[model samples]
Target: MSTVYLVGAGPGDPGMLTLKAKEVIETCDVMIYDYLANADFLKWCKEDCEILYVGKKGGDHTLPQDKINELIIEKARTGKTICRLKGGDPYVFGRGGEEAEELVEAGIDFEVVPGITAGVAAPAYAGIPVTHRDHTTSVCFITGHEDPTKEKSGHNWSVYGQSNSTLVFYMGVKNLPMIAENLMKNGRAADTPVALVRWGTRCEQTSMVSTLENVAEDAAERGFKAPSIIVVGGVCSLHDKLGWFEKKPLLGQGVVVTRAREQASGMVKTMRDLGACVYEFPTISINPLENADEVEEHALQLGRWDWVIFTSVNGVKHFWQHLRNAGLDARQFGGINVAAIGPATANALRDRGINPDFVPKKYVAEHVVKGLLDLDIAGKKVLIPRARVAREILPAELTRAKCDVKVLPVYETTLAEESGAEIEKALEEGRIQYVTFTSSSTVENFFQLVKAEKVQDCPHVKMACIGPVTAKTLRDYGLTPDIQPEDYTIPGLVQSILDDK
Candidate 1:
């Protein structure tokens, strides 16, 4: 059955997204979203899903409201599941009701999924609770700017001023001065506390506190614009004591990740949680080798090999799947010893019910090769599962130690085909503060997508490489690494970026 789900995409932070919202988004056939919805949510969409942006910003409407309703109706009739993603509550300030009514009249099956409205969430993130027990008991949400085409104003300033309840105004920056005047005229105290939160709950969030009497003039001097929330109440006084999100150390800093799409999720989430504006520019794609059957063939002879070494996380993953394809499990590896180069690779081995017999202290080739050489497995048959193209140090060192090392190409890493416009624009404008490269492949492929000259043009955009090897690859491109951690891992790389700041 075809259904249209009206989904609330939360205010701005992607973490505020509800589990149900994520479920519907990933499974939907078409996702029709607007400017208010966070772009980060698009990553949750499954492959082959259709994404259409009808985002309306200021007076620039990508598609008229009536046309959006018609599009939803037309998509529903075509038997395709549709997800109408709106920012905050779908029913808050937009044409959500009109669209719902249109869907009802069209006899389309639909469901309404609620989201965290900005009025509540923005205030909370700003450290100003809209309804504190010490302040007003009631709260009201109002649109600061109404329809420009309306002949008459429907608002009663008297009721609003005398209500003595906390008032939150959406899209009210431009009309804040007038709103403040009207509230004071209608028996509201001129000294009432007011807070203007711009881009609330986001990395670029900024808050300004002022009294009702001088707020308008102060806003004019400070240059506050629309897309801000106007909180009017005694509750706003707590902003100085309670504001936390804006205090984040990395807030508003832009960092780009050039890892493969499959492996960048954890790194991306960590940067976002620290209040850095993260851009995922995946530069490579990991695919199984064409001779994938060779992995299964090699798994069958696991009993003959004295040792097995998995070099990368991708190596561990693909090798295990092919091992399973051969109808063999971890038990088949019975007496063969395993070695993993890094903790992540070791954990991947552990997940498949095989803990590595040896894991080096450092992920570098010298440390890993030395640790295995110290095991005194000279002349032993060692099967190494890794990418088709990788550093030869491990195997070369093993061979020198008289160990018979045979490399099994389990996976291939190829440059991904993706547009470089976003990253180019960010670098050109000096907006991106850092570009994080997790591997030599990411560094090499990143330059393939974004020109070296463009990076040279933006000296402010420093390179944060995970390890010395990746740093050397970046240096080959004529760019020096500004951040390289002593420990070669994602958490270590993130700490180095923080320390660099």
Candidate 2:
């Protein structure tokens, strides 16, 4: 029989999840998640795993506490590895104790994986230390949500108000006025600094600072909502000097990445680290050609060619694979001069122990042709390994220079049929601030998935292309790119977005 794991999903950021929690999630056969848990974590689950949402938001409950407990027990009886994923530390006012007790009574084996509570993490992300030697030496976590079953209040407001410990309230937005009034009436200073961090630890995090006397008013004025952490103490005064997360240039900006799934990680990490909520909507998928026999045949005849040019990283990778499959290695290229279209393509070749003799200053077909012209290969036999469908300018220009060129297909790029629900919703709500295109293929396929009319309707949504080639592709669809970096690289594109803001 499988065990039921009660896991805590830390705050709102997936990066905060513990390694043990991630392990259990990845191996679990069933996942029952809460509303506050980041949905991004679900991507770690197995393909066939069953996901059930038993989230509770405000007064609305998708499934009552009793029902949730029963569901857990029922799932455990089926002998499947079940993960009951909750938000924050399950024992820190998360009602995890009740679930554990029920599991014990039901004779089910279970384990608890503790997580970082939002009360501490949220304040820290907002630059407010829960405990400091110069401020308070201790900290306390409290629930602002009152218990209806209790005949009287269990909390001693006077003791809490007079204590030297820093106070953190969970789910306190609705009762902010009452909590503040009680604290002040019981001896806490009305001028005490307080900070409210909403959507804490995530890219959309925002913190508001106010005095205890006017925190409720300030929160209302600024439109702060639930799923927020409230910190009340002298440490809150340090928010301005120590505040960092919200100050990120693209903190709340939403960007859509149209790179292939395998190639999207670097760009995703780059954008996300800069505090942009990245939506990976890959419009193209790169795959090796159906038959690499021709590529393998050409690779075996590498010594016969005077020049071998790789147009992309994909070309280098696919061609290298074919070379190795044909019982050959980089040593076979010793008699041939190699050229790469860009530094990335050159680096790929270098990784395979074959450094290119030429890398064009400009990453384009025309520049590749110009660079090859300077090589003085008028009668040289050249081989070009690249995508199945691409511009013929390079090969045509080389042929015009009196060189015999053989164009070999090493890989192919095709449109990826991915669900557009998330992108559509983001566009409909005007939440997508930028759509980034890394290549002409990404630009063309992106327009295929998302109609040009819909993109034009979202006034807040702007287009960002990696270089002039991609920008030209956007222009072909009658759409002008709002941001294009001078460097024409991933980092450059991100910098352009930051600069535009």
How would you encode candidate 1's per-residue C-alpha lDDT over 1-501 as one tens digit per residue?
A: 899999999998888999999999999999999998998889789798989999766567899888999999988899999999998989998668888999999999999999999999999998999998899999999998898889999788999999879999998887887999999999999999999988888877888989999999988898888678999999999998998898887899999988888898899899988999999999999998777877888898889899999888989899888987888899877999999888898999899999899999899888887787789777799999999999999889889888888999998999998988899998887779999999998998988889999998887888999999999999999999999999998999999999988
Residue 62 lDDT, candidate 2, scale 0-100: 97
- The TM-score of predicted model 1 comes to 0.96
Error of 2 at 72 (Å): 2.3
Worst 10 residues of 1 by lDDT: 55-64
| TM-scores, each model vs. reference | 0.96, 0.96
Off by over 4 Å in 2: none
- In order, candidate lDDTs are 0.90, 0.90
- Residue 137's lDDT in candidate 1: 97
Q: For candidate 2, what is the lDDT?
A: 0.90
Error of 1 at 240 (Å): 1.9
